[model samples]
Target: METQLSAARVSIRKGKAKPFWYGHPLVFSGAIQKVDGSPEAGECVDVLDQNGNRIGWGVFNPHSDYRVRLLCLAEENAPDYAIQDLVKRRLEEAVLVRRSLGLPSDETNAYRLFNSEGDRLSGLTIDCFGDVLVVASSALWVEKYRAEIEAAMRDVIKPRVIVWRQVNAPLRQDGVSEIIQTISEETVTVRELGVNYQVALGAGQKTGFYFDQRENRALIRSLAHGRSVLDVCCYTGGFALNAARGGATNVVAVDSSAPAIENAKANAALNGIEDVEFICADAIEAMQGAEGANLVVLDPPKLARTERDLHRAIPYYRELNKAALECLGTGGLLFTCSCSAAVSVDLFLEMLRDAAHDAHRRISLLKITRAAADHPLVPAFPEGDYLKCFLVAVA
Candidate 1:
């Protein structure tokens, strides 16, 4: 642990310490009243309250609207440590939490090790795919101490390959350019609940696989016996394969990405799952075409990245879900989801109601679930719970 206190002191505006005290990590630029010292971009800063009382420690960024991402709070006296120590400490705690939850066990080797602010490491997410670890950083502070972060990961995980990827750099809001790329040598094969999958590592979407849906896939498998299943947006066929494994009478997986469809085919071949059909097509159109799937999985990508996107996104969600509901019969089941943090569970439920009305179908809500245990979220922070999965019984 580095023993030097940050040179800069940031004072929060009047009455703006409530959320900070409540463990919220975000402090927008508007909440700051003044800066006591000139701090460089991505520098650690001491956060003080309106009355100049020490609140905690946080990472500073001038270019971004988010002025500070709180590293940790000072319950008593502020700790004398650098950002590296905070990161490593969080990493160890996160690993212990996952281990307690039985992640990377015999049945599963792929999962989210650290979930952004959920694990209190704001703007940093690390997912483990077998021996490979994909580290995604969205904050400049993370980039400033990239070496320290990597070193901590090495010390904690000792992973075979660590692929660093940049995502949504807020510093690039100006005319500055942002380069987004991933470094991976080869695809890795991983297992989840006894199902084997060929993960495309960094090249695939959001670290190649959605391990957040691990428990949801298990639920699908348990309910898929003797059903005609349709998996839309089947990225590498996670749910589709699980459905087939669960003894689905007929399985059809569709995705717009040709590479994803090909990879899904490879995964099917890897598991000797010959009965599942893989299709590369538009998901909404495919859902409209398939009129009689008893079990349908509608797991689409993040539609509303931010709150501003809800207008355009709500219609898309409604249309997609309406099509999925239309594809189901009287006794059919529908597993729908929204990965957008901006779309709250209540809003998603309202959209589903509208969708069912549009599809002219009666729906009974069976269950509601979020991400798996490994992807734990802070209940105080609503955005931390990004995944909203709904299991509906169509009648």
Candidate 2:
């Protein structure tokens, strides 16, 4: 049965094989020359070059623009492939990668375990917060192999609870079923570099916390000491609480969501840090009226969900950075970030440049950071590197 399922062959157009050979994992719809077998969505299929030589094996999605997400590259002398075996191997590899990074280290108990395409598992993302594992499925195929995937994860991390969330992804949603494992506690207190944060898996943003910002937040310890820090759009106070713990004399956390601000305050108090102030207001408006902060962090929600929104997103990114820049004191540090996959790093930097010019401020790019080690980037898939952090010094 497995062999028959994996035997479906797809041929690529004459010049389109270049990307597949060059290590790009996605085979676009238009690149396909022909499909020898009529494969349904989420089926494993063999991808061949124009010459009919097997190039790779991937998960096929007829409805998605990315027609195939290549899971295994063909070895020069080897010609065998199995979807189940590949999945088991990839899941173990992902766990080993995180273990190599010393993740869940002494101070941190939350991090990404599987980064979808980054982990060679293109359909789903799994994150670990303390003892709970949050599984976010975006591809319909993931649901097809839910049991195997969960078993594989259990073989590795063995988390106490696994919460499933089917993100309203752009991919086909047919034949997908929810997987839920009950636990008494829906919320877990996760520790990141000594800062304790209560992550509500039952309700909150992606995976209950932005574990990608761990390293960047850790950097605040050295830069925020004695500085008046302002964390704009501070969801659950990740940065603000860390800044306070880092010995910042005063920290102000602002978010549009009252619940988020409340969570921020609770997180601050959880650590017994009193110098931080929580404010519920539109981050842009708050920053526009705010000033004198020695350190400002502008980590907003994704501005553009798709390429069509790129032009509209650019202006919003510019305006937000401009407002935040105005709030920064001379010689202050600005930790600007964007999670918009549609917004490239260069474009974000350009947005920063325009914002600096408009604010009449001189901004020095001190460092460029990215998602924590756990959210590994696949060189061939630029979209995997979605989180961008720019640490700049404003004067």
Clashing pairs in 2: none
- What TM-score fits each model? 0.95, 0.93
lDDT string for model 1 (215-263, tens) is 9999999999999999999988989999999989999999999999999
How badly does each model clash, as a count of residue pairs?
Answer: 0, 0
lDDT of 2 by residue, 143-204 (tens): 76777677777776788988877666444343344434323348888888888888888677
Error of 1 at 375 (Å): 1.1
What candidate 1 gets wrong by more than 4 Å, as runs, is: 1-5, 76-81, 169-180
**Highest TM-score among the candidates is held by which one?**
1
Model number with the top lDDT: 1
* lDDT for position 111 in model 2: 89
